[model samples]
Target chain A: MKQFLNNLALSLVGLFIVGGLWALLSATVSPDLPSPWRTWQESKVYILSPWEKRGEMDQGIGLMTAYSLFRVAKGFFLAILIGTPLGFMLGSSNTFFKMFDPTIQLLRPISPLAWLPLGLVLFRQSEPAALFTIALCSMWPTVINTMTGVRAIPQDYLNVARVLRLSKWRQFTKVWLPATLPYMFTGYRLSLGIAWLVIVAAEMLTGTPGVGGFLWQEYNSLIYSHILLSILTIGIVGFALDRMMGFAETKLRAI
Target chain B: MSFIELKDVSKSYGPRNVLSGVNLTLDEGEFVSIVGASASGKTTLLKAAAGLIPYDKGSITMAGEAVTDFSTKASYIFQNYSLLPWLSAFENVNLAVEAAFPDWPKPMQKEQSEKYLQMVGLGAALLKKPSQLSGGMRQRVSIARAFATEPRVMFLDEPFGALDALTRATLQQELTTLCRSVGRPVTALMITNNVDEAILLSDRILALSRGPGATLSPAVSVNLPRPRGADLLMHDDQAIRVRNHLAEFLLAGSDRERPAQRPEAPAASKDVPVEASI
Candidate 1:
């Protein structure tokens, strides 16, 4: 409880200092720019109403925000599903490392947006395109983290498992998997952040019902306050997800 | 019964030979300690006996059966506090128990974990993580966890070497009592850099020579009274003699491995740790 209060106090102090400065700057610089007050009011109009559709319905931000979150969630799951096993392979097999390292390096530097067209070509749909793009963007961190985690486990731990004759499955589940989970989760957190960043661009491409799509629409309509509203929503949600992952990591590692 | 035999056992890593021509036999339930200077083959020999590393020549046999690779039921307590960093102290101990007895009732498993932690004087540390515990506390948890497995033989590779001297002595006392207790399925083989530790607790101390090539020098038998305590064990003449012999072996072995071109070595007597009575 004491820790909770301390953290709350720090957060409030930080929020007020930053928020007050932003409000002052916006109020002075341009009437077009929404002060914190105007932006908060715009957020209520654009965000809080969940039934607001993306392009077709009233131009409120709710549906698009949910869509963006869903795309990120799908991409994160897809990345975990594929990236984890690949990481295990890379960590354990010298051959896999040799084969994949060059390809991974070649591909990782190319933008997630670069894959957007290819994803559309492959999937023949907007949702799949968004997911594929997010997955592509997120995969490197997850795979690299897991592989390094697996590699970092001390030889003594393996020796103990071997001396006790841990079965291959038992070893994977008990030793290999748990040992790597922390690493994998760390990767997952990084990937989630990346996926969140990519989703807006992805939605813009797809014209999908998401904050990205709404932001694009608001720009087209020249409604800067609504655009600010969508961007704020994305930032807040992205920050929350990262915080969730960090909290989980703290709990897991402490145990 | 010559429960374990290592005949002409040799191990090499590519061009570097660690142990060569090690011939030793351990009988049923005999407690032994292997002592040596840093870089000696004490740890190497223990690893070989545990079948963690394959010997290039000869064979290591347990109960007349040649052991190849690591056996199915051994518990290894490593010196570097290799308690799975993600597990709590109780969970670390419980995991070992679960592996050994998968079918055990849940409450019973928890009870057994608590029992072992209590034995090591760490009953309050059950929920604490490895990072939250000190070096001495971590070593004790690892020891308790290994013992919780009720292993046929517990192979320790200097589990207390990293700890401070006082903590090492305290653990030694705990280990002696824990192993000597009736109806326990444990037989201990610990490797140590501390010569005093070997003399205090071992029934037999196998000194490993230092190496570019190293081997077990000779096995010095300790006839100290069982269930030894600090007060009674401090005055034992046999313990003193064994400690002196180990000190001599450790020094001579160190000198032999490196040529006389090195700085003159300290006297072996000064190297002996007389204050160690755990």
Candidate 2:
């Protein structure tokens, strides 16, 4: 209880510090800059009726956030489905790894935005293009981390498998899967973060009807307060997503 | 036919020979221990005998069948206790039982698992995972797992080496009792570095020369009475003599000083108790 109170106090102090800096900047610098007070006031309209729909392009903050989250979930899930099995194959077989490692290495460093044009060209649609970019961007971390996890399995465990003469299936299900779970989750967390990041950028570029697209529209209309509101919303949602994954990781480890 | 036999067994890792021209045989019910310096291929030899690792040369047979792969008839107890971290003590033993007797009903497997765990004094810790158990308790779980399988041949790789001295002695005593009480004869091949442990547990001790290309020294038979206890072993003159001889052999091997005289092969003289010559 004491520690919780202390943490709450520290969090409030941190918020106050940021608010104070913003207030100072708004007062001394250009009035065009959105202050924390202005951002909060602007946020109230969206917060009051977050699910309101004005138009296809002009939905409420909640709708935009939900759309963005949906895209991230789809892309991230796809990445996991493709990446995990590929990682296992690569990790288990040296020959397979040798064949594909260079290609993965080459493709991994390319930015999500760079993939946007390629995705657009391939799909000829903004929504699919955005998803493609998100998945492509998120995949590398999951694959690499999973492979590392599989490779990092302690030799003693493998020896136990051998001595017990555990069937190949049992070795995979009982030993390999559980041993690599923590590592795979680490990759999952990273991929989710990347997916979230890429979705916003891809949506912004493609002008898809999501939080990023809404932010861009607000920017075009010179609604700086709404822009600040959207930024705050994005930050909070990203934090929540990360915390959820962390909670799941803890639960899985207990099992 | 011997329960387990390794004839002119040799193993090499690429260009480096780990074990060379090794021959060993263990009859049913015999408890044999191999003692060697660190990195003397003791583990390699044990693994080869269990068919867990492939030997580059020679052959290993168990009960007249050529041992080419890991045999469910053989159970191995590792020094690290090698219990799946995700599994409880009961589950670990149950896994071994399930593997050894696939046709056994679930209830029978569970009963056998419980029996072995109880025998090893881990009945209360059946639900505890390896992470939750202490080093000693983990090893007990491992011992239970091995015995639950009712293996025709058992291989132990420094099984009690990781525990504290007190735990080691206690587990050693527990093991001796467990082995004697099994009713059916069990062939056991053990690799240990501790001389006293070898002397206390083994019917015969085979000392290995240092690697690479390590070979077995002549076997020194321990004629100490069965169901050996700590108290009995402490006061026994024969146990002390055997311990001293093993200590000398270990020390000499470590120092790279060959014994002045090499004894004839002791494997041929089945029940003959070879007195330790210092």
Candidate whose DockQ is highest: 2
Compose the digit string of candidate 2's lDDT tens values, residues B1-278. 67788899999999888899999989899999998766679999998888888899999999889998888777889999999999899988888788778899999999999999999998899999899999999999999998888887788999998999899989998988888888888889999877778888999998887677888987889998766777765789888777767666665564453223224324443212222221
Candidate 2: residue A232 lDDT (0-100): 82
Off by over 4 Å in 2: B257-278
In model 1, which residue pairs have backbone atoms overlapping below 3 Å?
A46-A61, A64-A210, A64-A211
Error of 1 at A159 (Å): 3.5
Task: Looking at model 2 chain A, report the run of 10 residues with the lowest lDDT sum.
Answer: A39-48
lDDT of 1 by residue, B1-278 (tens): 67778899888989888888988877767788887766656777888899876779888898778887666556788888787776799988887787778789999999999999998889988899888999999999988877887777878898788988788879888888887763754567888877667777787888787665777878998887766665544678877777778777766766555554224445453333322322
Query: Per-prediction TM-score, please?
Result: 0.83, 0.92
| Runs in model 1 lying further than 4 Å from the true structure | A1-57, A222-229, B103-115, B121-137, B184-187, B229-235, B260-278
Q: Is the docking of candidate 2 incorrect, acceptable, medium or high quality?
A: medium
Q: Candidate 2: give its CA RMSD in angstroms.
A: 5.3
Angstrom error at residue A46, model 1: 3.3
Task: For candidate 2, list the clashing residue pairs, or say none.
Answer: none
Q: Write the per-residue lDDT of candidate 1 for residues A25-121, one digit (tens) a residue.
A: 8888877777887777766856576666544624566566677788799999999899989999999999989999899888887787799999999
